[model samples]
Target: MLIPAVAARLDPGWASRVAAARRKLWLALFHPRTVLEAFRGETPGFRPHRPFWGMRGGVSAVFVERLLTLLTALPSVRINPVGRLRHMASGPRGTVLLDFAAPPGGAPQRLSLPAATCALGLGAEELFRAAGVDYAPQRLSVAFGWAEVAEADLRHCPFSLLLAAPGAPALRVSAGPVAEGGRRVMALEFGHVPEGLPHPGAAEARRALEETGLLREGAPMRLLGVTSLPCLQVPSFDNRRAFQAALAAFHARGPEGWAGQLLCGAGRLGFDSMNEQILTGLRIGEP
Candidate 1:
């Protein structure tokens, strides 16, 4: 759903407040290190006895960071924000729409809730109560299989081929064409499951990767995605790497067939970049 449409249904002033809350939550989840100091101990000037309100005031930074890491590590968990008050979170378990509201004349006593309440099986009320947030609940409609959706979307879109390897923690090598400064350039993204069977060491993995022709020689790679298990983004790749060929190569070497399945889809450039901007702006300690 579009954010503006959702915000239009809320009270005039509430929209901005909700947007602020969404921003704060995004920052805590994506940029945990920036706010680590806040969670080292009881934050100064935070009076729990007083009617402290909003997520920044109500929840400890440590709790937020831990929750973010836990939820993102799950096999299934998607957070899509439609507006300040309306958020869509879904997983293999179920889906939820969080509709937030502010108590009149004072800040909320709680600002965030555990992912388990909404993502696992707990009810919405329980989630709000735990986070000390006051909110009205509404039914949420859900569609399953986010990976399937991605596959479908990329089926007809132009893209480059990357390799997928199956192991305890599956690995996906993302390579594709991206539009940059009026020209098109190749980009590579590397991701792996956060939890699972032990895998190769970084040096071994890198050595193996260099042999496969997926990445260019000495190409600079930057980390992205959730901080706890950031994905690598490489700006270029060797010409020999092809999607189908890589898939075959990965499959030939293993009985597990590259960690159960292969991922084929068009990569979206700048999506992560935009999200980072939002996270940086909403960092904790900002008034």
Candidate 2:
């Protein structure tokens, strides 16, 4: 049977240091509640919060949510939705040890399971680095929020569009219309500016949206939000080589070491690849 609680314990000081090295606060800050909400919406038992109702354009979330719901219903599965992972290591008896901080003020906790039964969902680049793997981000994401357009008014606009210009930033704008009585706004995401380059402010986004025919030329685009994710990862030869080397080294320690445990962002370059990863994780008892 799936147990909500794992039968292991962890040390508070060690967990604290791991969390500090991982900079959990920075992770929490960079990924605002909106992004986390969309991520959580991909999990089983995801009920669209009132504010998130009518949200569209995140096709990956839709696909994964349905798939996970069906899988989680199988017997012997447990879901522990509370806690922040701090560290992972090998334990005695061919098991792996997962240390984390559970709710109520980051109390230390641990879970021990057979090595073959554990799957690391540490897809974020920062998380892998925290786990002692050396690699760098191949791409980053910058988001901009513009003036709200009523869904009814934008019925003709496509759910998403890509815009690029000769001397401007390329962007992918997606519509995320909240339910009635809530603020509805469209979001624009683009690649990060290179080092030493000044931010291409909201005006750039407005111009791109206009050129893409999603915004009127003279529309008042009152910027509502600006978010940056500097650690986004994508597949590249160097990244794959480094990742594979790290996995091999981790495995060399022991047959059941953390070799292939990392669920990195290598194959999740797009929505279709992400869906494939989700399916693979479920089939292999990783979910």
Candidate 3:
């Protein structure tokens, strides 16, 4: 339901631009010289235009590998012509559209825009920083899906309870049902509060949703799960260590105990196939 609402408001021209940007991103990621130049800050006279200007700031090869790894793991990406791509990540709270493009005489560019009343926060900032790109945040007029919940169950939902918990970080939470294949699952979203705004407590958000009639007490929803765009970092370029640590953590949590997993690129794992290792920790739907 939230997906259709967000889709209706998309700029018709964004698809093509996004495709162009994805292609450029692929080219930069695959080209060894481009990668080297980006890391060293040495512009080879005839370098293929970098897919993202942020790379010019100097990137670590480890970081680059991790970035590519994360990109490859994303379920919602389409790679066409080996370079151009289109991708979208949607949840109950909102959606994130990643568009890339290259214009004549201009740098290869990417636009990371949030939809469905979601706004960019520290995770967005860390994502761009890790990639070494500069981005400007733009706010949009869209509706959050919180209103769809029933009031009677509001106190029981994790979003409300987490916000009400002592020592919980100031956050903006959103929830709704998302259909994946034939199954519908509840998606709980947590985001950092935008800068300079008063921390709107959980009670306030709960009241707003209830007042709007979005909180329905009996919606027959099940399988409460949560996710966030958390900033993942490595002390150095040893991705293998990071991967091993993650793997150990996953094993320690077993299957059901694992709440959610981070979508990260390279640190200690170093070129290991994430499909066989890291991605297994993610709980996509009901157990």
Candidate 4:
């Protein structure tokens, strides 16, 4: 499952700092208390200290709404109301942590939503509890924690695969040359992979990760389904339409980039809310 979330960039070269902040926020949300509440089925909220990089492209209320609209169009992964922290998770149990920046950043931050976009995710456990429902596992997690995928690893990697481990499984993908010498590496696909991938030992590596707890387990186990997708973009310019079209083509399945980018040229770009008309359009999940 891939969750595509977008935000604005404060500096052109703040990849490390930016990645740190993302990690912090994710950590804050994935706590024992929050995880517990989530299992019972409730929507939780979080607001970590804004990282040093300022705010990425998507943060304003309007952007969030537009994102919400995109959410509406998608399936399951709906935009839930932001509330106080409910349940979160306790981890180190293996969650695929990643952060990317575009060309400038040179690392994780560079791999972020080129256009203003990101993702709002809710796992299975959270879903059940939020809807006042029960699940067969009879178990669930409250929140997801922060993780860091090595920049070198993600550099040539295609996309991230999210799975509710202990059940779902690890995301099987190609390793290209990243894992060549059995170096316990991370993958960073500059943007999208060419073709005929599924790296030679990708499946084997995935199985190992599934059991090791890096690719699976931890928070996703209870959260329910997962979300992971491209929040990619090309370059920004006056002729934005041209840029959008090209980037859109790059937005494909399996470790690629985002289909769309947001037009963030306002004060400290933030998120938008698309509850009404915007909030009724899509589908996405662990794929």
- TM-scores for all predictions: 0.21, 0.61, 0.20, 0.18
Q: Rate the local accuracy (lDDT) of all candidates.
A: 0.30, 0.51, 0.34, 0.30
Q: Which is the winner by lDDT between candidate 3 and candidate 4?
A: 3
Per-residue alpha-carbon lDDT of candidate 2 for residues 26-127, written as tens digits (9 for 90 to 100):
121223444456547753333463432332444457655776697689787776653665666778988877777677655677887778645666554434
After superposition, candidate 1 runs with Cα above 4 Å error: 1-170, 176-211, 223-226, 229-287
Give the residue spans of candidate 4 off by over 4 A.
1-202, 214-287
Model 4 earns a TM-score of 0.18
Off by over 4 Å in 3: 1-192, 216-264, 267-287
Residue pairs in candidate 2 whose N, alpha carbon or C atoms collide under 3 angstroms? 2-76
Ranking by TM-score: 2, 1, 3, 4
- The most accurate candidate by TM-score is 2
Q: After superposition on all CA atoms, what RMSD does each candidate show versus the true structure?
A: 25.3, 15.5, 24.4, 23.4
Better of 2 and 4 by TM-score: 2
Query: Model 4 Cα displacement at 23 (Å)?
Result: 15
Candidate 1 residue pairs in clash (backbone atoms < 3 Å): 110-132, 166-258, 166-259
Per-residue accuracy of model 4 over 1-287 as CA lDDT, tens digit each: 11112111111222323342332111122455555666688764445644333124222454666766986898777433343213222113222112322334333231122222434233332322322333222111111112233333332343333332322323232222222343323332112222343322333334434454445432221111222232322123322343333333323221233323222211011112233213322332224
Q: Clashes in candidate 3: how many?
A: 26
lDDT of 1 by residue, 5-76 (tens): 222222122243433233221111213442354456644453344552333322245456776789788878
lDDT for predicted candidate 3 compared with the true structure: 0.34
